[model samples]
Target: MYKDDGFDLVFSYTFPKCDLDGSYQAVQENSTHKICVDKEGSVLTAVDKIENKTLADAMDCNCLRANLIITSVEKPTCEVNGNYSPIQCRRGTCRCVDNNGNQVCKSSVCEVAEIDRDTLKC
Candidate 1:
């Protein structure tokens, strides 16, 4: 069931367990909505809706499959020079540093490479 905040209207429906979760905000008096499907506790993708479209139409129409396909084409940003590379390497007490002063990065640890002649790098 859906309820309108400003109006005293209530909408009821019956369907499978699929649920949409996201945020909506009014920008300059215009409504902007983002809706996503929670697939097994993970958000597969946020389906973008056209202006002034109903929520049911947004999901049932062809947009859902198109959005999923586009998202699937994107690869994880794991390249050394990428923005999130440092945080990804931090799990091993390592940081991505320039290799030969170039943009390429190699793992470099902050502490000494040896501790009592045993490697203590995380």
Candidate 2:
């Protein structure tokens, strides 16, 4: 409704903002990547493999831009630069993840005894 109310309303059906540079869109459930899209949410960039000369970077639903581990994006605590936090806690277990969100350092999942500890060691 930001447009003018005129006879052009019946002639054009597209939004200008959604047509240029595309619009930021949400990915499917359980998916780690968000995408830029058209008005109807069709992928507009070549980021599937991230090998093209076009756009390559993507932000996960968890606000993570570097790590894209399967089943790990959900309920994640991310760093300010979109890297996965070094330590994460969930389901009474805590673990360590690398910059790419992969479990690393040969560390085993640690069981948390106190629920009030914000910082966890793995």
Candidate 3:
């Protein structure tokens, strides 16, 4: 379904899920977000969908502004059961030291793998 609701074009959220298509992928992830080129792709802008402290503390605002994208703002949901529990460090703390001595923790409360240094961030 295409509509000229004011923008150049509009694509439905169910756009093709192709990893190789760049521009379309961005637009799919965010219908309002556009793909613009500059002397150096000079902007980075995407609303943060995750609410982890590390990202909030370390994200570079300049980069975020340059590559802006209309990220899906809908917060995620968690499937719970009678025995369901939030992901925790092995010791139940927020963080743990990995074999490499890097602090390991559940990047997201719903995640299962213990990511080290944000590498496993969902």
Please name the candidate that would achieve the greatest lDDT relative to the true structure.
2
Superposed model 3: Cα runs more than 4 Å off: 1-50, 68-122
Each candidate: RMSD: 15.8, 12.6, 15.6
| lDDT for 98 (candidate 1) | 35
Per-residue alpha-carbon lDDT of model 2 for 11-83, expressed as tens digits?
5443323324564333321123324333355543223323321222433323342233346634667643243
Residue pairs in steric clash, candidate 2?
A: none
Which has the better TM-score: candidate 1, or candidate 3? 1
Backbone Cα, N, C clashes tallied per candidate: 0, 0, 10
The worst-scoring run of ten residues by lDDT in candidate 3 lies at 75-84
The global Cα lDDT (0 to 1) of model 2 is: 0.44
Residue range 19-114, candidate 1, lDDT tens digits: 344322111111333333323323333333455345323232123223333455532223211112222222223333231112233434433322
Best by TM-score, which number?
A: 2
lDDT of 3 by residue, 1-122 (tens): 23545556634544433335332222112343332222233322333324433433333232222223325542112111111112224432334333222345545533344444244332
Off by over 4 Å in 1: 1-34, 48-56, 61-122
